[model samples]
Target: MVSPHVQDELRIFFTSLALGACMRETLAEWRPVVDEAIADLVPREIDTEYLESFFGEPTYAYDPDGLQRALSDPLWDLLDRGGKRWRAVLFLVFVEGFGEDPMAYLPYACIPEILHNGTIIVDDVEDGATKRRGEPALHHIYGRDVALNAGNALYFLPLKILTEDPGNLPAEQRLAAYEMLMDELNRTHLGQGMDICWHNEREVRITPAEYLEMCACKTGCLGRIVARLAAIITDQPERVERAAATYAELTAVAFQIGDDILDVENSLGRAGEFGKEFGNDVREGKKTLLVIHAIEESPPETATRLQEILEAETNTDDELAEALSIIEDAGSIEYAREHALELAADARAAVDELALDAETTDRLYTFTEFVVDRDV
Candidate 1:
């Protein structure tokens, strides 16, 4: 466990990163907007291009198959229209702190985020998720087939970027980075597959452990790999990789758990509206930690009612209300929140073990806390 003073020191350190002279200079000309806050802090034109292109006006090659148009059209609008790019920025920040030029790793830095964005585009369709970033989903805007192709294109963007000689990184290092990236990609897809299959089949009962496992794959793995890659960029591959991976694993679980809790409470802003009907997870028989815990802790009658609600062909407002009531009565939300807090604690400890520069260590630790505690 990390000592309280150490944890507090780490927090102070990260807080300082926001206001430090170095960061101030870095942040000086850059303004923080919803779309480009992360990009603002970066020093390079290409970094900005990479960031903005994803968020702003992005056009790709033309093809009658619509592959180019579909894949290229909504990406910048979709990515730039929303999201903090916190994960990508975190990678760059840490890379800078390690005395490496962040520009050297720009290609690698944005890959995970691009992959994440790609998944979101596809997932909105798969999950029938409607709203994104406070707007209609790409599928809703462009139609499903185009939206799917657009996501596929975003998914491939990283590959092209990775193979480029942007940083002149050694072939061995590039290969290692690619391997790590592929691993994360595999996990993310696997987790998504399970999530979608569970939604469709409704036969596999979920336990908290299973939910965590899924979260680790779908969310945690990529986050961890990003951190690990940062370490690799900094040339302290082993220690940083282990530390970042540990932090990523814990934070990812906390992130997904928090998302689940938000889903239940309807507190997730645009993403909340995108929800598959209200209480659609239950209606679709998706197994989430909240539902699993609620089932375990609620009264038998409440459990039966919950199952009936889930097993029903569709969920009415009354059924949704009843399910929410049962979940509240069982204190599942509180339990889930506590679990997230615990994971945050684990993340702090994990980073503390690394022999990172004071600033990097502090920022990484603080970032984890922010993720665990973020309202949105």
Candidate 2:
């Protein structure tokens, strides 16, 4: 949950931007169906029927209980914590943008969504995060070994489409899907590697462009996967596919920036915010756009103090609160918010330029708005 004071500030901030009032369609039309598909894809209980259907009849003896313990339990525990599931919704929106029924291509939504939850699990481990979605992080509850295996397993689970022919694509289409998924996955890993290097070694001072490029590689990945996969499923031409993917990537980048803002917001109310404890990013010495901007723009002593706080072995509430005050004084929070708003607007404009079906384009627009607006 967002901190009360910060949530009030953000509600005022977002409201001033004239963002949409609500996103009921996401819950009414999207959430139930997307979650149901996820349940069917990633099981709570492993039965012979599920295993054989997904993996075909095993040559060796299979243990249902083993899968439930090792894979399904921790996975569901994390997923059950709750996610916006926007990646799946984005895939469906892309399908409709090409004048196809999103429901017709619904099951494929699991591809990006599961990959996303996988990344969250891995991220929490890497960040040594304590909580996710208001619960102790998976690694903290389950052993690191269990969480890691479960998280890593999520990466490969969606590939079942290739062998199982769940979507019943022609051979060529299946090969294309595999290629796109691998390409984006590789890029995301590279982004994560860059992030790790920056935070782990505080001497590194990265430029704004470098940070954005990292986001383009990491969080930006799933949107491309969702949109391009939608393009594939809908049989759209290459031009359409490229356009859809570009628009979705833009939205994802904006969403990433907004999340960094939430970390600061989390600091205001408590300790960690989004991924772990409120102000956890501050504790981790994360180099978010807010940190970067404040460092560049603040008075020398203020900036130096901020950097020192971030690079500290550990921080106190006083230090964390001071760092936030420095950022706010430098206007970095509003600066981050402005950039996020611009990106969201750019994403929406890209959709408007597409000149797709009116309703389809509207859904895309609303989704993009929802991304930046939701947290506020």
Candidate 3:
């Protein structure tokens, strides 16, 4: 069960989104207003004509049926599914921290969310995931071929927006931002590749340090990009921007570890609420911090058994339950929870290094706690 304080924090976050103070809602109730605003930035029609007319036809003829709908519809469907909007919110919060109007960066704020959701669509297909956010995976509904094309299209959408002058940012700064985005994308893919490779290999043992590094690249890259973008828009000093980016990276590590712990606890019934099966990480043989710690700390025989279960092609319900028992018996769950708190504290410390107002610093600290403590 969620504590009252955590519940209140979630309430405020969602309330902010609903009031259009943080996010542009795409729900049916707010669709008209939100769609109008988004249309100004992302057009309804995403046709090859724009590409051909703007950049000339490619060397090879390229076409897809219902190109516009194929590209935009799936994106809208996923976005409208609802999320915490954490990255976008963090971008705005940092903008406000720098004494600028948060609303001014709204269009650019959509960049993180678009990139994140696009990645999720692809991740689901790659991981053979059955559900996402309590609904069937995008590929499950739209089919893999169409979903892959749509996901790829969404990845480039942000770049197209950056090339434009929506933020009215200087050309040099825009170029710098584009470079930063590319850098983070490369890091994210590298981290994902490592994870995919590890899962496919047999009898592999990953150290806790390696697992943390992977999380930094896979998850931290998202946070770093938004924090860096905030610094860019605010025109802060390089040192201050680096500090903020570091804080964001630490926060991402805590967030991912917290998620790992939740997968084991399964206390919130995430399978229903988050569209992730209970213990899916174990089933996929994910090298989460908890799994690493449990294996390293367990008896030699027990460790071998744990690894064997993880490497199995499939496990019965009883086998999965026993694995959970082993992890708990090894006390890895509590260890992970305590470690997440430590990471969150470190993230808060990094925030203090930023030269923001007292109130913004306090809010950022609170947000770091929220990142780790959230139930969903």
Q: Each candidate's lDDT (Cα)? A: 0.69, 0.79, 0.76
Clash count (model 3, backbone only) = 0
TM-scores, one per candidate:
0.78, 0.87, 0.84
Report, for all candidates in order, the number of backbone clashes. Answer: 2, 7, 0
- How many clashing pairs does model 1 include? 2
Please write out the lDDT profile of model 3 over residues 1-376, one tens digit for every residue: 2235533544454345434442323223333333333444455665666656534577996463476557766777787677656676778678888888665666677677678878999999999888888899999888899898888876887667676656788887788788889999999998899889888976657888888889999999999998999888777888888899899999999999999998899832243344445677778777788888989999999988889989998976666777888898999999999988988888988898885887678767767776788775
lDDT of 1 by residue, 34-76 (tens): 1232232222233335445444444763233343355445776
Q: 206 in model 2: Cα distance from truth in Å?
A: 0.3
Candidate 2, which segments miss by more than 4 Å at Cα?
A: 1-21, 28-30, 265-278
Best-to-worst order by TM-score is 2, 3, 1
Models ranked on lDDT: 2, 3, 1
Model 2 C-alpha lDDT per residue in residues 10-32, reported as the tens digit of each score: 33422332344466433443355
Name the candidate that leads on TM-score: 2
Residue 271, model 1: lDDT of 31
